[model samples]
Target: MALKAPSFLADAMLGSVARKLRIFGFDTLYIAHAHDDEILKMGIDQGRAILTADKELFKRVVKAGARGVLVSGAGDLEDLVHILSKSGVTSVDLGGIGSRCSVCNGLLEEKNQEQLKNGVPGKVAEQHREFYQCMDCGKVYWEGGHLRRIRALAESVDAKLGRAVAT
Candidate 1:
């Protein structure tokens, strides 16, 4: 059977991992100060898998009908990504790259230059021909150098896993 791309509700302690997952385009919810019970309840209610570093929390969440991953090491974002890939928990939809906001998890909508002519820096507006606006936060996104860097990183991760990029 094919694996589904699981949405995640990351516990308060796994903020970095949550951010990384978000960068990879997963719908990750990072609750930085949620109580363990609240996190478990939210995961169950939202049908979201839990990602956490607390073993006890993991056990409790599993009992509450929510799946979870108990991370063991710190400062190992790449390793966490690898683990998710190996577990069939991650899917790379490179085609939808930059479709989501990196900061607020909002969907990005295309914006014309005229609409942003006043808000963007003069040099940026003059140089870049395309722009996307975050529907939730109103932040603008462009096909900047950062996109290339992220794509390279995703490619490396895919290569390391010996898997073809998802369509």
Candidate 2:
């Protein structure tokens, strides 16, 4: 049987990490308002590994026989590297083709420029030929400076993983 890619349930404190994970095409559920018990229950029920910075919550997760990762990194970059490493992702997929919506964890579907209608500013539509819309939230995305930064971070992650960055 083929191994499934790891999915995650991140706690309120790890929103940034969750967004980065979604950007990297991982399935992540960010529970910002749920109680610890609710988060734990959802994580186990959905078969998602819990990502948390709370020591007590991690302990509870382990005690309940749920898979969990204790994230205590200095920043999102470090936490992301650690999480990806733990999930056995040796290389990052820097291509934005399969990325999820950072805001809602929804799948992104590529859309033609004309299909965007009033979703994007006129200047953005004129400059960028490619576009993606969140299938769940309808948020529009295009290649921009943020994408460059994500690529650079992916390169750094690649180097740290001892893998050559894919062009």
| Local distance difference test, each candidate | 0.73, 0.85
Model 2 C-alpha lDDT per residue in residues 1-167, reported as the tens digit of each score: 03567899999999988888888788999998989999999999999999999999999999999988999957877787777777667767666424799899999999998898999999998899999999999999889998777778777876776542232
Once superposed on the true structure, which residue ranges of model 2 sit more than 4 Å away at CA?
A: 96-98, 163-167
**Per-residue lDDT of candidate 1, residues 1-167 (tens digit):** 15566778877777766765666777778898878989888888988878877889988977876777777656544655555764575445666567777777777788989987666888888888989888898989887888887777666666655552353
Alpha-carbon deviation at 7 in model 2, angstroms: 0.5
Judge candidate 1 against the unseen true structure and give its global Cα lDDT, from 0 to 1. 0.73
The list of candidate 1 runs beyond 4 A from truth reads 1-4, 73-80, 86-91, 163-167
124: Cα error in model 1, Å: 1.7
| TM-score per model over all chains | 0.81, 0.91
